[model samples]
Target: MKLLCLSNGHGEDVIAVQIIKALYQQTDQIEVVALPIVGEGIAYQKSRIPIIAPVKKMPSGGFVYMEARELWRDLQGGLVGLTLAQLKAVQRWGKQGGMILAVGDIVPLLFAWLSQTNYVFVGTAKSEYYLQDEVGWLPQTSFLQRKLGSVYLPWERCLMKNRRCLGVFPRDSLTTHQLQQFGVRAHDFGNPMMDGLFPEVPIVEEREEARSLRILLLPGSRSPEAERNWELILEAVESIIAREKKRRLCFLSAIAPSLDLNPFCERLQAQGWQQNTTNSLSTPVQDKQGLEFQKGVTRLLLTQTAYHSCLLSADLAVAMAGTATEQFVGLGKPVITFPGEGPQYTPAFAEAQTRLLGASVILVKKPSQAATVLHELFSDPDRLQLIADNGKRRMGEAGASSQIAEYLVNQI
Candidate 1:
């Protein structure tokens, strides 16, 4: 049996690879290949999955939907030609007969549908939480939303209901229930994004006598955008230091392995932050790649290797990321987010994320506003617990990849 997995964007690729990797464990009878529609599909490459189609990194970085300007830029960058070529490749592969696993949103899903092959969709983009959380509908709705209601939209539901699309796995239970109500074969096996997010080392609690507040910073995984986010996050860190000067604060910047640390270090150096070689200010951590920077009493550790440990150990987070932020919230840690100019983490995207994650994500208008928000959050233990509970409910528990992979093997 042959399987062609289609995914778009960095987050989607991660989710796709997790399931495909699990699929490998479930059966050796299947021959799996991939087609990443956005970026370089580094996640697939890292997973050792073969690329069955040509992929180009577009100017929009697969987030053309964020703004018309991004869409125009991608068009100028030959988005149409690249997409046509990819579609042709999918068709060529589909002609030989196989199953398609479409991850991300409509782009890959539409590609799988166009292939005229049986396919399953793991809807990573939209979730029912975008429209309404577990409690009720959010405020300030557009008339279109009031009428349409569902986040999957009408045409998307139609695609899921089609005979060729055998299974639909949405991000959350609410999304699955919504799709099923529309007669779509949606399943709520939990989100694969929540899988394999364990810490590299067991995060021990601080002794009560020497306890300090720990914060995590996620500046996204993408390049120059992450650099810019680092600057913005630094501004917030400065504010946090200013506001809480008396208290001991440890900030962990979970730098993505793909990002170069020098540029980020330069930004801090410009802001009067000096590298703390002694690691005197930081709490015990397992990352050898971690570099500690000090600006007075505030200690920031920029680590490429301790990404999961940082998330698990954090008391809270100041984030401007997609999958990383979601994963942090999945650990029942509250996230404070602000907008950035982007093809990705734009103001619109941040607003939507707050809706998707509900109370788990506290969206502020500016980076400086984070200090006040964190101050407020620390004071309200009940609210903090509520946010934690909401995060667990929204993101769901892990182990979804194996379940979905097993389902695929049985069906195939």
Candidate 2:
């Protein structure tokens, strides 16, 4: 079997490879091809499979204003420029041989219909409502948004209806139900993106573990949101540290490579929280003068890292609501979700998240309230333990990747 995998960024590309790798592991007769949908990132080169359809250089310099909302619109406006390029790649490969597998992007859906290849669209978005509700913060909006939301609804419905595509979702029961409503055939396999999240590290001699309580802090991944997130989270961290001096705080900088971090770090200093750069992979500089928190409060910055490894090492996580929240829950760690002010955390988004997780996770209405919740959670260690226990129960077991891979294999 010759397979063509459609992938976007490194995360999705990694997922594409995992499925292909698993297929190869199962059968040596398998022949694979890769067709990257987004920028020509290192993931394309890192792919061991053949790249019969190489990524084309997208037209550059689509100007986006620095304002968050406007920036998002500008980014979305540029999608058309690459359509022809992507279509050509798909046409060339579709004529050759193989089935298609799309990973969280629309290109595969469009290409599959045009090429008439049996394919599966991994259901990253449960409904048009799902993205609007869960990830409204991104530049894109749902078919329900005031401007672009309704406009795209007819088009989206048409694509899904005609494609005869199978929808694959992360083994979340609620999300699978939503997909069914859209008239697309849906399947739930554990989220393979979270596979191999934790590697067992042998505990050796009496080496002091890094921190008593390793708290993972994920601000939004974009730059505009990062500034606001840094400010809001620092305030909460201050309050938490003051009340509970024994605990240590850690920040995970998962910002995209396109942006800079100094400005955000400087803002942290303004809030009386010094940069603990030593632990961050994204930033190597060390700050000698650590910010003064409550007597026992220490902050460490974890630079760019495999998030799963971080989750594996963490006791608890406070994440700005997004996909990371799900990953934290999958690791059996309780995550506190704050729908911070912005398009991302609107009232609609919060409700959808609550429904999906069945109240297994924590939702904070305001950033100001985070410290109070954290304090309450810390005060009752049993409650935190319950959260962790419940998280694993809700997220289910690992190996979702293998299950999803099997579904894709059947699609061919």
The runs of at least 3 residues in candidate 2 whose Cα sits more than 4 Å from the true structure, single-residue gaps closed, are 8-10, 38-42, 48-77, 105-107, 127-170, 175-185, 199-211, 246-259, 271-297, 341-352, 379-386, 393-396, 407-411
Report the C-alpha lDDT of model 1 over 152-241, residue by residue, as the tens digit.
778887888889998999888888887888899988899898997777854667787777789999998777899999999999998998
Q: Estimate the TM-score of every prediction.
A: 0.95, 0.71
Off by over 4 Å in 1: 201-205, 278-281
Q: Write out the backbone clash pairs for model 2.
A: 133-349, 137-344, 143-149, 143-150, 190-400, 280-303, 281-303, 282-303, 282-304
- Give the clashing residue pairs of candidate 1, or none: none
Best lDDT among the predictions, by candidate number: 1
Model 2 Cα lDDT, one tens digit per residue, 1-412: 8777776655567677777767766667667777666555446577666665545433321112224565556346555555566777777777875777777545556776676666666644343333332334224433345453322254654666565555545345444555466664666665665676652222122226544556667775555665677677666666666666655454443443444667666765566655433432221112222221122246455344344445566666767755666667766676666665544544556566654454356777765676677777778878767666655655556676667667666666
